[model samples]
Target: MIKDRQLYKLILSILTVIVVAMIGLQLVSSWTQPQAQSQLNLYESDLLLQASTWQETNDAEPGTSPLLENLWGDSDPVQQALKNYQKIKTSATLQSGPTDDPEKRAASEAFVNELDLRLGLLYARSGQVEDAIATWTPLAEAAPSPGNQRAVTAAILQGLWSDPPQLKPQAQQQLESQLKGWFRYQSLSQLYQLQQRQETLTTLRSQEHAAAEKALTRLAAVQVFPAIGGLTGVGILIFWLIQFAVKKRQSLPEAASTAPTIEPIEAQADQTPNTPQELAATVRWPVTTIWQVMVVWFAAFFCVSFVLPVVLYVAGAKPETFGARGQAYLALIQYSLLMGVGFSILYLSLKPFLSQPLKWLPLRWQGSWFSWGLSGYLAALPLVIVISVLNQKLLQNQGGGNPLLEIILNSHDRFSMGLLLFMVAVLAPLFEEILFRGFFLTSLTRYLPMWSAIGLSGLVFAIAHLNLSDILPLTVLGCMLGFVYTRSQNLLASMLLHGLWNSGSFIGLIILGSSVS
Candidate 1:
């Protein structure tokens, strides 16, 4: 960071070019990511399926749950399921034909075919017989060899659901064995109903009833958790209206509490006041030098993010090939390396500029850090929740989200979940706060107004994620993080705030995921 102007400029220029290219690649990667709402739809469909069934012969308290009311909208669970399945049908992939890449074509067609099967069954169950017939008619008539499983399944459905048995008597016998899975289990009760086999239908319906009870119980947990969190957020909002941001008295350094004034950043290095105003209150590192450090920071960021996957790929450790636990563990290692390499380079870059430079960005454990963090957490929840709901509506779940969230949702076992929690709640907060809030926001304050610095750093933090759909919500969350650190002047406070936010997301996703699974 402290070097000859021409030499520094040359290095910075090269880094700038490389970073631009990396950013472009990241943009394409984000934009072109396959839409995975099918996963979410599948989960929600299960909950809705059970809820609709559970409401019958149970004292279901729909009127008592206003929070879940919005989730299901004005429609019954059957209608909501229908709508979810229909949305996926509309956006189903590879409607034209298989893609150029055989593997991609296979994956896309499988996904679309699954959606079609689900939508058709949902239609039949809801008594939209004509719709079901329309949807499955093509599948039943299509060339069986290409999609042998789906074709046979639809043909079987056609035979059972038609006015008279539509199957060639021998054809159903040949194909029925191929329909072996949860898919087959789900269709059994429906098939019994079609056949008017009262005894078998009654037995299968009883099994369904018991399974639906378990599902609704899980839904209750998932529903109750968010409602409680939202209410806590609302309570905090009310308290915040009466008292905003950490009070002036709480913001002052402990050393400055006895005095009305404290030293500013530009104060002379040799003149140490009895009380300090901020970290690095005496060191007068030039704003220009800080800007150089920022460049080095981003250069390392781009290199690690862009190149690490390639390195891992060449090492035969493709992330996508891993299961939940394996992927989570690999992510932990990746994050550790990122902080290790990025910080080492950052420290070396800054060492020449200011002596004991690490002191400038201290994570002091003193003062009301917990309070500040809690306030930020409370404020962040409702605000982010509102934005997220709107974000889904506006984006229609199109812009890709963090791949990590998906991993967290699917991490079923305790060891894997703990690994993810450690990475997200502990490691991520410490590393990211140091880089974004400790260094970047602190540096920006020298050139811009405090609030302006916070906002700009927040925007950068969001953009760093390389996700368009989440940018706005993450930006809002980031600004609250910056605000806490700036007001409290303690890195630990921001870390706490960050950890809580991510932990909350992890918990909520896991709850939804576990229930759905």
Candidate 2:
């Protein structure tokens, strides 16, 4: 009894360690995020105030204050502030820095362009409209981000139209350039917006199609129907475990948990139980061959779930015609039904054929409900943040991460947020945990060292998320989940942990939105 208890305790402790490590990783990642914008913000604010002060007076004589006099001399404070702003402007010129990551380099160029826009805004406000227009003209050309270019060009045009005719001919031409630029800029902006909308519609349609196909596939693929199969499988496992426990009690003079002088008869019997390895032997065959039954069911499920929708999509069915609310309900029903079918098939097919008793599937309570859910969630939160930072900094810095995809996918709009929430807080953790912690870790541990199993599973999980940019973070998360699952031999525990990690991300998104304003 003591030895068995010790072994269980050891497993629990290891699981605890894995959870703690993951949390620590998250905290560290959150701590290391750069505050570049925040650091520059105050300086920019002070500069803006100085410019405002300068613009307040256009006098040639220096002010009475020594600091203002020394800084502006006999020149107007507004002109001097503008000159200083121009100097900052020159320093802010877009330049290729030491970066292998094309995305990061592109981000840097965008940042420089933004600085130029800021300078232009100040110049325009201070009545240097021509100068402001001139400055913004190159930026609109250089970066050419539809959104930014539109804003800058609009500002430029406003400055140009607001300017007096006394401004030089060159300034007048610059104003004309701004006008000409608007023609190309407006068209490009509209085109980009249209393309974005079309892409979103396409993705939504594909997701709906996939969901429908999956639902139908579930219905058809059954070797055995899900509802009955799962219950029966669970019942059978419970029956076997009870029989084993009973037999052991009858034959043994003492408890199985206790160290006995002799091996129990039931234990000895169970070591060579009357369980067949083959499906044929396991399920009395001939009338219902397992393989044939499974294949037919799967084919039916696939045809209904996958093939039909694909055919419809290929035939040019318009999902929008169905309405968004209707489509959402359809998707929900399809997913829920598919899940039910999967669970049913899983319980019946795999559990029934396996030689081991079903004691493993029982929902063993770990701690208080709150502790189990909330503490586990708290433990997993750091893992998400860590993975994100590592993906951004390490993989991204090396010029290997998919920055452009990140930028496009990460647009802070409704569709982008929805997808981001779904990917990070839903699809990723669920599918990833099942593959790495549940499947790969289980298989690897059967043949290799525990650490090796954990490490390999983590690596596979990272790669599967599909971008080199995510490698570091996903791998780390994978390792954490694998280790926790392996150590506890509790798939439920890790699943909870993974779910909590995703929830934390969802919460973080909320926090991020709140912070942005």
Candidate 3:
């Protein structure tokens, strides 16, 4: 017992030393690197000029569209343009105060109107017609100034006429109403008559019919599967909730009648193996010791996940060039080092508390490992699909994209792709499972019920990624990992499931990038 206690202390000391060393290295790197270049100031004229150039060079090839390039490429001129437009519009809105000088107020409003017109045009040219309409609709409707209304109306008309005609009846009616209102307000009867031409309405109706037929055909091809999958998931959840409520109600009566009593020595004997060797082989450390191990485990996790990224950022190590293999190599090295350090900390901290540390760590292979892993993988597929669809819709609504995924897609090369595959599919699965499912879930089970422990561990696992957008889906995945680990009592089962999940995503990314290229 004395030796065991000393060994535990020594293990903790070693883990502490490793963590401190990592922090020191990060600090040294941050201090040694040179400062980054200052950002350039961009104006509306510059952005418009850039947009014009991009549009001129835009290719119809899958990945060659200037808008896509700017969205996913290293130097994002289009995003910068959008940002500048937003900043100018915000400043103008704030500066146009009721008490301000008349000249200043007029200048502010003028700039805001011009900026909105240019922004609407840019969005239309970039093939975002909805966004263009969204930009111009309010300006055309709410602004009382005739000049502002005219400028916005012209831009909206130009956008509607430019491409794939905006032929939806609602869109057309809304625009026509705004146009009629503007014409009546300004007494521009000639302009209104031209817009009301029968030929124009006939052409727009034809375009709308064609577009609707194409959309309906495409929707008919694969719409049924998603509807069925969504309904199935909802049904399963409802059934489970009802069953849980019924079980709880039934259990209350049993709990009220039963009185707890001590078990006989024979019953205790039956729970354990007979021989000392067998007892040593099967015994696990007390739950308290597992919790103690987690303190060190999480410390190492934070050091890598948070501190290391800050160090890399300050060190000017971020790669600026798309498809730069050097960045891939750097990422692999960073991930490897971090995983090694974290695993060492977990293993060392937990070892002394168990008689057979490897078995107690649940590292031993089980006969049913493959079966459990396969089942878990199969179960994860529907959940992954549901979450991915929801996330895509959310991103589309926000007009946002995933920077990390964009980087990965842009950085495609033979060596870099292979390295990414290994890091994501193999290293990530092994180390992440060991930390989250093996250690964290086990530790939580010491104090909480098994299901509650699984939930809390899953939440922590999601939080560890440090990505708010990914938390919900990642938490769902983590819970699945925990369930597999608990059911199989084998870490390898969870690791296998994790590897399969990541491998599928990595392969999909590669395929998508290839198609785009």
Candidate 4:
């Protein structure tokens, strides 16, 4: 028994060392990598700032912007800006367009327009009047809305009428004719209208900044309040533990004196069991045996869930087909198969070890199970919200979110939506609860303390999702599920709670996606 205990300790120590080493390696790797901005898509403001910096530097130094010097040594700022503009334009064309969401397309268009305007200004500053006119003319023609057209026109006129007269007489005449053709009736009135439009845009931008600041302030409050609440709870727990320990020390003498002494024969009979059944009841089974079940479970999980998906991916089963809907459907099918195969393997492997597998798993429905599940669902809702908010904040701090989840969420078609709903709200709850709580947690309880089993299972469940950003929140959710299963001894309870949590997330995502669009 001592040897077995020592072996377990050694294994644990080895695992701890391995985990620490991996974390250290990851930190080192991350430290060595160059840091970049978190936002996947650059905003118009970012480009505008860059453009303004270039303009300021060029204006101060005649022909030498630091940006141009750094990017293209000794090259003209106008040519460097044009090259940058072309690169941005090409990237924007490839990455975004009519097929993208409305918000994304709008942002892309705004960036492109800003880039064009900047390029036009750079050309005008360099005395390339023809190039400046050529740059702005297409933008004016391509502007979808009257407001956008007016903005473009205003930029064009601003460039044309700027100090030192950038335009040659012939090009100025051509541009004026084009402007007349565009406005049709009164050029002066149209120019005034354009100026007013620009003012309105500036006002709108100011309002947007104000709204963004308000939203950020609210988000900060949300993050702060939860942390404060958590700290208060911890403080209360620590206080209670200290008081309990003090009280226990004070009562130790009384407890010793009051404790009854047992007779030798009575003690021997109590300690020694007469039958195998009695001995089995007295002796606690070691939790290490549960590893057998885990080995089988993981083997099945890896083969079906990991290996199969990789094979399919290699075999030209692209996720982005059918407007990225195919990938969601594929994931649904993959998870469904994984659950089916994994459970079947687990059942086969565990069947020989237990006479009543279902009873052992405690899968039977119990009284008040609905109430337990409903309560769990209700409790989990706010936790999910809090954790989601924190997760987003963490992602912002880390400069990215879960890439896999991002891909799934980015799919907007009906098929993808339906498939994602099934994957999250139905299959995920059913299969995940079955594997994590029904099988793994139940197996773990045979050897470990109940809380230890719950925690280990929750940790495994969180890790199974393969998203570091989601680990904390998912672990919390998994522990909640474990608690529900442990209390009710009915898998349905946890499944119900899981489904409710997932459905809420699905609804929230739908709302968020719609709002963004």
lDDT of 4 at 433: 89
- Which candidate achieves the best lDDT against the true structure? 1
Please rank every candidate by TM-score, starting with the best: 1, 4, 3, 2
Give TM-scores for every candidate, taking all chains together and pairing residue i with residue i. Answer: 0.82, 0.41, 0.49, 0.50
| lDDT (Cα, tens digit) per residue for candidate 3, span 292-365 | 56557656666666776688779866554425577677678778877888767776766664434444456556
Candidate 4, 1-517: lDDT as tens digits? 9999888767755655655455444444343211122222222222222333333322356444443333334654345545655665665555454654687678667757656655565565567767766777777677556456545454555544455433333333333444321121122323334446667444444444443333333323333443454555456446545876978742111111111131123222223223222222222223443554555555555557557658877997755453566667666777788777877766666566454444444455546668767676665555655776686465443322333344444556777788888788888888888778876775555445566767899988876654455566778788878877776757788998899777765654443333221
Give the distance in Å from residue 51's predicted Cα in candidate 1 to where it truly belongs: 2.6
User: Per-residue lDDT tens digits of candidate 1, residues 1-517?
Assistant: 4568778778777876777677667766665553344466567566657655544534556476564455456887766777887876666552425458888677766667666766777777778877877887887777667447777777777666677656444443443364322234356655656557789767756765666667666666656656777678788767766555546333322322222133344443333222334433443445655656666666777767768789988998877788888888878877888888767865776677556656657566678889989888887888887887787677666667677867866667789899989988999998889888877776665445566667888988887887776677889899989877867767888999999988877776786677543
lDDT per residue, candidate 2, 286-323, as tens digits?
A: 22223332333333334345654676589887544644
If the candidates were sorted by their lDDT against the true structure, best first, what order would they fall in?
A: 1, 3, 4, 2
Off by over 4 Å in 1: 1-3, 34-42, 57-73, 93-99, 165-186, 194-203, 242-283, 305-309, 312-320, 410-413
Candidate 4 pairs with clashing backbones: 287-447
* lDDT (C-alpha) at residue 311 in model 1: 90
Worst 10 residues of 3 by lDDT: 251-260
Q: What's model 3's lDDT at 208?
A: 38
* Off by more than 4 A, model 3: 1-292, 305-323, 363-366, 384-403, 515-517
The global Cα lDDT (0 to 1) of model 3 is: 0.54
